[model samples]
Target: MVPFGRLLDALSEVPDPRRAEGKRYPLAPLLLFTVLALLSGATSYRHIICFLEQRRIVLNALFGCTLKRAPSLNTLRTVLQMLDRDALEEAFRQHARDLLPPAEPGRMPVVALDGKTLKGSFDHLNDQKAAQALSAFASAAAILLAHTEIDVKSNEIPAAQQMIAELGLSGVLFTADALHCQKNL
Candidate 1:
């Protein structure tokens, strides 16, 4: 795992989408808090908030969190909704790249590609199905390289193709499900 301070530095440049006048917390710290909570097995906004609340003392001592109180679930939801998705993804990828060891000379990385429906994502109130995402994993390193969401109207085939191509892998061994072994691909 990357050092927490380095992680904070990597995320410091992310643009905050909140109005300046109403900004209660810095975007970098808030994002760091959320990511830390997620890494600790927080799977929902409520869980993340609770994690922050419970670990407030330790977090403040370590990271100098200056929050008067833990952010509410609504605040977290709004910030997440308004966050720049592309910027966040790029930051995450850069951090992951820093953590990954360099490939050996004349050796290619082995990457696994797959798609899975996100559990507990079904929108029962809206009568919508669970969200599906295509992911790329560096096999040896056991870390996710990247991912893309499958459009609601489309299947994994197209999403997988786009994700693999965007990865710009060269001299790399790509493995995937039978669905991606199309003759045209």
Candidate 2:
């Protein structure tokens, strides 16, 4: 199973004690949609719904969902939009840790940090660029940790430092491209 899938499973296991239920979709179905979205390169909620409709049976079986009904695009959009992004990130990180092999004491992990652009999806109304900074997979036991958006008028050094600081790479070796080789970076 993929780390993201395992993370979703772990997250689904957490009981919601709140008496006020917001939505009604089963955890398995939601997870199935998430996995399908990732696999099909669907970056938006609408795309995920379309992907789910096409692979209904396979997804249902993969996620162990017993739902007699299929979720609408609006339903999925509302549910996903309301979810706490921080909680989702934490779940993904925890599952990533679980999937990683045990690190040897003397052998430090090599983390390659870099940034990227999303190519599209920029909100034109807000005048925001569509650059999505991401941590690319470099090697086993290591990750390209964080990224910062770079615009025409702004520099990324400070943002990169902030990201690196949050990563807490005490024993690990960090490497980046020439853009990240600044004196303070």
Compare the candidates by lDDT and give the number of the best one. 1
> How many clashes show up in model 2?
0
Clashes (N, CA, C under 3 Å) per candidate: 0, 0
What ranges in model 1 sit over 4 Å off? 120-130
Tens-digit lDDT track of model 2 for 1-185: 46556766767753432335754666544754666577779887778777777777776676566655567877776666666665555555545546666667888776666666667758799997676564634366654333445554555555556656766546767666688766763
> What TM-score, computed on C-alpha atoms, does each candidate reach?
0.83, 0.69
Model 1: which residue pairs collide?
Answer: none
Give me the displacement of residue 94 in model 1, in angstroms: 2.0
In order, the Cα lDDT scores of the candidates are 0.85, 0.61
Report how far off residue 127 is in candidate 1 (Å). Answer: 6.6
